[model samples]
Target: MPGHELRYDVNCSILFTELPLLERPAAARAAGFDAVEFWWPFAEAVPPASQVEAFLAALSDADVQLVGLNFFAGDMPGGDRGVVSWPTRSAEFRENVELVAMIGAATGCRSFNALYGNRIPDIHPGTQEETAVANLAFAASAVARIGGTVLVEAVSGPQPYPLRTATDAVAVLDQLLVERDIRNLAFLADLYHLTVNGDDVPKVLTEYADRIGHVQIADAPGRHQPGTGEIDLDGQLGQLERAGYRGWVGLEYLPSGPSAESFDWLPRHRRGGGADQTNEGDG
Candidate 1:
């Protein structure tokens, strides 16, 4: 319970995969979480209006606040990280930007994660970077209308993702600030990915605390529940708190067992940061 003081939000996209997509929000609420986050929930950049309504209705019915969301990353299960850096997909990314903004307006969700896509084999790296910068600028501007922060994350994988460290992601943020004067852009400190990519998490927490717009966690070695892996999540979270990050800590780990059963490490009261309010029992 070292980091019990921090507010936590369930990443329903990962945590409640056993249930259908629409039921995940309610499942989180049932597990005693008041807020949740997710990756792009649909198969396409813009789903049909009916699908959109159903997705929103699910959140409303569950009565959970959406604290974070990702812009439409291309076919994730098919190995696509994002379309922002793909020159051919600029229009798709921009269109999704508008859709994401609309969703944010409806849900009061302010933090948006924009995954920088992987390297293209045929395209020049310079061209990809240029496309990424322009797309990020567009995303930042669009989300700024709703008082939102656009998050850049360092992903860990073998697919040639460009941003693989806190410094790598922050460099893009810095470029946006200095060149475009975009203050709404920030880093998404995903500890599991950063650790997998060999970043010194403690050093990152100390050096770039202020630049972190959102935070996500899972245990390292295997992206499982906190106590099941090697990362000292509590200590790192304690450092994050001392360094003044008061944002929602997203539980983005894959459940080691049943989703409901995997939350034994986090008491129900602490999950919502309502230590004084008594819950029936821990989930």
Candidate 2:
């Protein structure tokens, strides 16, 4: 029985990388998903107008809903996971927020993720914390104009990102809500990263589901498709559903084989969310 309590969407940045960026949306549509999400679509915070136009046209062509997007994580493949917390990169992040807001509004995207910066040399922890909150506060305000919610995700990797646990991510979110008096800033509960960091997912879900704005999944030990590893993704998603989390659950995993082959666990009937691929070429 495929679950219908949640709407699952692929993270095009990770899942459909085999296709060109402009081609991923259609790939997702063909795979039966009517919605998709992504990391920032540009290498830089600001890019050429042509690039933005092509990206928008791609989604418009594919007819997939742009449900969620990240602001900008600096050089993700180069080992720079995020930069919003780094004081020196504050200006770039601020500029990116403006562009992120513009893109989110254009696509009718409802959620924006801001990954926390890793611990870099010469950047004091206290300073990074301050910068992260300030930038997020600004992002919350900017995106609120378009009815978008800002999210902070817990990350786990070789790098020392402060938000290595669900608690840590929620702490940042709570602080931002208090500091900015805004309700749009929320926690992004990623089941894979939380399990990777040795945090208990059920407890996190039990406690913070109401506060979470988004949910992402990839199995642990290897960030591959859900059933390829030990994490019980189906059970975890049930927790979210039981807790009343009706938002998108991002399939943010690296596929072990071809991206299309990765959805065997998800199944085609469950893939398009509640609808079939009837609107495939209408984008």
Candidate 3:
């Protein structure tokens, strides 16, 4: 096996149908996946903390890894896109770190993806970068203690926010990680966003290959599965392989149907071992 890891997001269906957290792993496993990824698991209102253990245990029993958790949504209290630099909410950043750390540990996650809170309409672009770097540095150190790492993602161009380029994300993340001397931090290369932001992804992947800790995929326009969009999935996958990328490649796309419907687009038979082909669309 090539050692590549593929995981799908719970939001791809669970959030849409209001399914329980514990049902996600089996649902994904049934969909031909051996792992799962999701936005902040802590943001969900159901499955009180006591049930977290059982949910994670189910994934383990099913031979699945809960690979990725997303941006700290808790910062929404400061503003919809909560970056640490929001003037009135230094405490929000601290709270997000603690809350996210707990969520990562509970699910046995090894990676967390950080997004710069949506770029405020009137804020200067440089200001957002400064805030994001500071916040990432603070948050990185915090998650490191829990055995999980942070992977900063570049927001898509069509999306609001000044930090819309992969170069922007990589520059800031690199500077912050180096300054803080944190080896646990890295970049999350999402081809969907990279294309949306007009980034030369393969070039970036080649240059900063060492800093890329995670990878994500989805087709363009609607952010659907790889086979349904304009992004060059084969080229990007090949680029990562050529660059020596050995980490997990998260299936972070909206399924055209239930996730199983998108399996043919994944590199299931590559270096990564083959997934057990089984019941693929029951939650």
Candidate 4:
């Protein structure tokens, strides 16, 4: 019986070169999911255009949706890999923005996850954040042109980025909202990062719930499956509901073994088939 609790769509990254992309839709659908997400493919894989079309075809055949895709690494002209304060890499940064837009256009994905990257000790915190805000603003405009949104992930590690803290992310998002006057730009709430960053899950969710456009979950420490970590998977989900987060909650974690094994941790549900092909990459 389906529980009364509202459930969000679960998405898995489908870039397993070992496993054919064609197989991904069936696997994800079999696991009672309707969506998936993934990072950019390297040049070695299918050419960008072919890759995009193949994924679109797979979703159409399997009745699943491509929810998110990460932008190419570093920078490309007009692409937004999004971090503008990573060392002195200006040219590379510009390239990322252009590449992101191109990828977005091809895949029909609307949201791109921009990492804050690692932080620098020598740089003043305020200075670093200012640079990030400026860069994101530019990227947001570029993405908006292509009917997409540029989003930042709240990273948490021993060496966190300028947008590491929830407070920092919220502040920057607020600034972006006002400066850009755009609603498409948003934030990513990765549960693993939230736990490692010492955030109160429910509190932060409640506070910036409206600004959140995407959410990922994995266990802390190893960033593996949720059950392996200390974070309360069920409770955090409840928080998502209280905050009125009615969007896809991606299963954006590394599986301990085969992706099939991860299905056991999720609830059991009927797997149905449809024929609509919606390929929109988001991360």
Runs in model 4 deviating more than 4 A are 1-26, 43-63, 75-82, 87-91, 120-130, 180-182, 270-283
TM-score for candidate 3: 0.78
lDDT of 1: 0.88
Greater TM-score among 2 and 3 belongs to 2
- For model 3, the run of ten residues with the poorest summed lDDT: 274-283
Off by over 4 Å in 3: 1-21, 44-48, 51-63, 74-82, 121-130, 267-283
Sorting all predicted structures by lDDT, with the top scorer first, yields 1, 2, 3, 4
Q: Which one is best on TM-score?
A: 1
* Total backbone collisions, model 2: 3
- Per-residue accuracy of model 2 over 31-85 as CA lDDT, tens digit each: 9998899999899988888998899999999998888899888998888877888
- State every prediction's TM-score relative to the real structure: 0.95, 0.94, 0.78, 0.76
lDDT of each: 0.88, 0.84, 0.64, 0.63
Query: Tens-digit lDDT track for model 1 on 1-283?
Result: 6665467889988999999999999999899988889999999998899998999999999888888899999989989999999999999999999999999999888889999999999999999989999999999999889888899999998898999999999999998888899998888999999999999999998999888878899997889999998899989999987876777788999998899998999887777643232211110
Best candidate (score: lDDT):
1
Candidate 3 residue-wise lDDT, 1-283, digit = tens: 1224332343333322335666776766665566677765544323366665665677777676666776555433344544554544555666667767776776566687776667566767667667766777778877878777887777664436555667777776667757767666777788888887788877877887777877877889789876788887777777777666656677677777755556665444441342332211110
